[model samples]
Each structure stands twice: as C-alpha cells, then as structure tokens.
Target: MSETIRLPHKPDAPLSYQFVPGQGPLSTTHLIVYLNGLIAPQSGWRATIDHLRRRWDEGGSRSANHPALLTYDRYGQGGSARDPADDQHGGSHDIREVVADLHVLAQEIRRTKMIKDADASNEDDGAAAADQVPKPKLIFVANSIGCVIGRFYAQTYPGSTAALLFLDSNIANSDQVSLFPDPDAPGFDPHVLLPPDSTVADLRRTRAGYAAHFHPSAPNPEHLDRRNIISLLPLSDGPPLRGAEPDEGTGPRITVVGHDWATFAEEGLRGSMNVPEGLTNRYVNPPWAAYNEGLARLTSADRARGPVIATGCGHFIQKDDPALVAELTDDLLRNIEADSAA
Candidate 1:
C-alpha cells in the first residue's frame, strides 16, 4: 500500500512512499528499496515493481519467501514538497543531501520493522523467539544518479545493506572525456564551439537530456582537475568501494547494469547539441564503458556482478526491459538466501 507521510525530521517535506509487505514471516523477508534517478519520481518504477510483486505473490507457497518492496520519492519530486530554499544553482539538491534523506528513510523503515517484529516475538518465549526480531536485510535498487546516494549510504551504514544493484547508473570521473574533450581529436575545438549555457531546467526537458546531464561532464568550470574529478566519483574511495574493514562478510553484493546502446544521442541535450560524430565516438563512449567496468571491480572480492549489458535498452534499462530487471533482482535475492542458508 502507499502513503504520503512527513518525516519527523524533515516535517515540511512530505515524501510519497509505497510499501509492499512480503508474505509469511516478517523476520526473514528482505526489504528491497528502490531509489530513482535524477529528477525521477518513485512512480517511474511502477512497471518493474508491479511485475516483481505479482511474481512474488504468485510463486505458490514459496511466495512467502519473496522480498518486500519499498519505493519512495525524494523531496521536491512527485508527491513530496518542493523547498524553494533548497532549489538553487542547477538542481534542487547535491548528492550528499539526497543521500542523507535516503538514510533517514531507511532508518525509519528499520525502526518501524523492529517495532513490528518485537510485537510478533511477544507470542513466543525462548532464545529462538528473541531471534525472531528482524535484523535489516536491505537490498538497494539504484538507477542513474540514485546509485551515488546508494553507494554513500551503504558506505556510511555498512551493516544495513545486504545488496546493491546499479541500474544504468553513473560512475564518478566518467565525464572527463565528455566534459574536457581532447583538443587533438578531429573536429574538436572547445574554444570555437560555444558550450551551451544549459541549466537544470533545460536538461529536464527530455528524458535523454536528463540522463545525459544528470552528472554533467563539468558541473562547475573552476574545478575540472583530475584530483577533483576523481574525488567526485561516487563511492570511489569509501568503505563502500573498499568493502567492510577486517574482511567481514558484511559488505554488500553489488551489480552494475549498463545499457548497450548509445542512447544519449536520442532525446537529451546531447542529441540537441549536435555534437560532432567524432567527439561522441572518441570522447564519450570509451570512458563510459571503462568506468562501468571499473564499477564492477569496486569491491575487493568477487561480489561484483556485471557491467552487464542490457541488449535492447538505452539509459533507462528498467523501463525498456522491466522483466530483465525483475530477473536480476530475483537472482540476487536467491543468492542472498542461499548464502544465509549455508
């Protein structure tokens, strides 16, 4: 079911959230939290969530083993309140603020679940009953810029996250080539061609543009150095990237899903920009593909899965192939279950 509720901490901004409870014992059911891309509402994930929920409910008696789904809109998007104060520069927020909001939301969910589990445990007496209280087993499904927030959250609260799925997500430092195109490349002259004075409003005009500019090649002109760019890469040097210290099994299982097609040319600012064919081929594609591969190796262990190419889709892979997303999510859940059983 869905509800529009205000967080006690951020009482002015109401968040639209949906919670689909899994069948059977609450203690064992995993919670899959869906984080939307830049400027996307929670409703964007409707098809995928509906498909997965239906599959879970219809899986016969084993339906009870399925994970619960939680999807929510961040502040200033969808049903949530928009803070004029927060809206400045190009966008409404920076990555850190969005991650903070997500942290609060996750904590609230855990708090509520703990209370419910406590109530459930009251019916029985024993060490086993005490164990009935649920420990958070959160699976994060992050798309685009949402991946940045997810990574930060997992790093900050390593114990809470069990798995992370990056769906057509961005990689830090990937924009270098696109932002600072090589001067030596054919038909490339940054000085000759006027860079469009694009704003967040301009990019939001189309989905492709939104995806392309979500993490602009250079958000600010002053800080384009390699060190600054590397520092800006999401989860590049965090506990999330390094995995939990002391080599405990608490690190999240991560997967990076990337679209095979060169979709930025379709509908966004990039399409409208009429960028030189040579520039797009030389500067854009290589770094993007390479960074995605780097994302696959972020974790120290073999826990990383795919820079998996989505054959038929573009940047919005979940929308293009919801079934594939569902399959991947289910597979991850099964893996988590197997590990727990072992």
Candidate 2:
C-alpha cells in the first residue's frame, strides 16, 4: 500500500511512499530504502524491487525475518507534492533542501506506522507498528544524484545507515563543460579527431545546448553545484574526514557500481545527444571512472569494493541489471543480519 507522510516543517509538501514487508517477522528492525535519480520517480525501481521481493518470498513468508523495503517520491518528483520552494531555485530545489527532507522522511519512516503488504496478498495497517521501527538500521540503494543525497544524509545523521549501494554515481566535480571536447578551446582542430559522420557543427551544437540547459539544473527539477559536494565530502587523500559519528563503527558498508563503457556509449546515442563514439570513449569515460573511484574511497579500504563495472548496463544500473542489483543488496542484507545477531 502507498502512504503519505507530512513533515512537520513543510506540511504543504506531502511525500508518497510504497513499502512492503519482507518475509520476516513483523517486528523486524531493519529497513532498506531505495532512492531515485533526480528526475526519476519511485517507479523507476520497480524491476529491481520486484526482483528482491520475489527472492525473499521463495522460502515462503517468515513474518519479519527479512527487512522491510521502502521507496518514495521526493517533493517536485513523482507522486509527492511539487516542491513549494521550486521557484526558489529557478524552478528546482537544491541538494541541501532535498537531503533535509530525506532526514525527516527517514525519521518518519521509523516513527510512524505505515500500512504495508504483509505477504503477496495480505495488508497490515502500520497504526500500531511504530515501536517495531525505532532507530532501525537503514540500507540505502541510490543511483546517480541520489547517491550524493544519501551521502549527505548519512553525514548529517550518523549511526542511521548500515549499508550503501551507489549505482553509477554522478561526477561531483564536473563543471558541465569538461565532459566533451571544447570546439572553442585553444588550438582546436576538427579534422584531426572528429569522426567521419560526427560533424564539427553537430558537436558544437550539442555542447552549447548542454551548457545552456543540462548541468547543475538544466531541465532537471533539482539544482545542485556538482563541484560543491566534493568540497563538502572530500576524497580520502584530501583530508581526514569524518562522516560517521565517533562512536559509530567503521562507517556504512559501501558498494560502488559503474556503467559499462560500451553499454553507456551505445545508450548515449539513443538520446537526442548523439555524441560521437570516439569522443565518449576518449573524453567521457575516464573522468566518470575516476569519479566512481573517489566514491569508493569515501569509506575505508576494508569496507569498500569495486566501482564494479555493471556489464551491459548504462547509467541506470538497476534497470539494466536488475538481478545484479538485487544480488548486491542481498549480500548487504547478510551483513545486516550478522550485525543484528551480534
């Protein structure tokens, strides 16, 4: 069942969420929340979430043996009310505001009793279930800009998250200009590197359109300075940063996933922006990998793995590789179980 939550400060913006109880005890204390990319709705997670739910149901319902799952629409996206502060960002909200709302949503998800499907067919009203969710550990499955939002939330509210899965993280330091070749830069030459079909005019036009409307907040409803976030959460080598509170153990479990270069290269053409293959491979791929590398470094060496390239996947890892996404989450679930048993 879908539920609406009203945050105390912003009562005008009600968020809608859909939750399902795993095949565990109704009293389960662990929760998994999936976050959508900036422009996506919660429905973007349907394939992946449905896969995990089926896997849990295989052994039959076990009352709350597994963690409950939650996914919601942020204000100005999906089923949630449009951000009342949309005009404040020139028709969008910034990452800070978005994270602030998530902090409230996280608390509410634990404090309020939300109606959810108990099994494939049964429904339970959450009216009397708040006690079961107190300070419950959270595992966040985040993609693209959602990954940044998750990190900001965990940083502000330490000891709340248990595991994090980052899917093809956005390049936090990109200036919206460096992803492609500069047709106007010094010593620019169209003949040396340009492909046979990719004209100089085509490349220049795309870059202009992208610069005017894409980065930070082009057509997107969320405005964020990609470069600013990295400053807020610098790489491991930059300084000794502390995201988790002191008493909290060695940060949350981190898994980084990057899109396969070939797949993403192909997918890029499917859109209106027909970036030349040579440029995508030469100019776009390297920096994105480096950015994902930085994301992996956000945690300690022992706690992180991969910028695990998702083969046959593009930017939407969950959609392109649903089983892989579920499998990764399942592994994290085991870690949560082990922690709980301890």
Per TM-score, the best of the predicted structures is: 2
Provide TM-scores for the models.
0.75, 0.84
Candidate 2 minimal-lDDT segment of 10 residues: 236-245
Residue-wise lDDT of candidate 1 within 35-56, one digit each (tens)?
8875567888888987776667
**Per-residue lDDT over 251-273 for candidate 2, one digit per residue giving the tens place of the 0 to 100 score:** 67788999999988787666677
> lDDT per model, in order?
0.62, 0.71
Question: What lDDT is obtained when candidate 2 is compared to the true structure?
Answer: 0.71
Query: Candidate 2: lDDT of 74?
Result: 85
Candidate 1 wrongly placed segments (more than 4 Å): 25-29, 60-62, 83-92, 117-132, 174-247, 262-271, 274-278
Q: How far is 92's C-alpha from truth in model 1 (Å)?
A: 5.0
Q: What would the TM-score be for candidate 1 when compared with the true structure?
A: 0.75
Q: Any runs in candidate 2 off by more than 4 Å, and if so which?
A: 22-28, 60-64, 87-91, 114-133, 189-199, 222-247
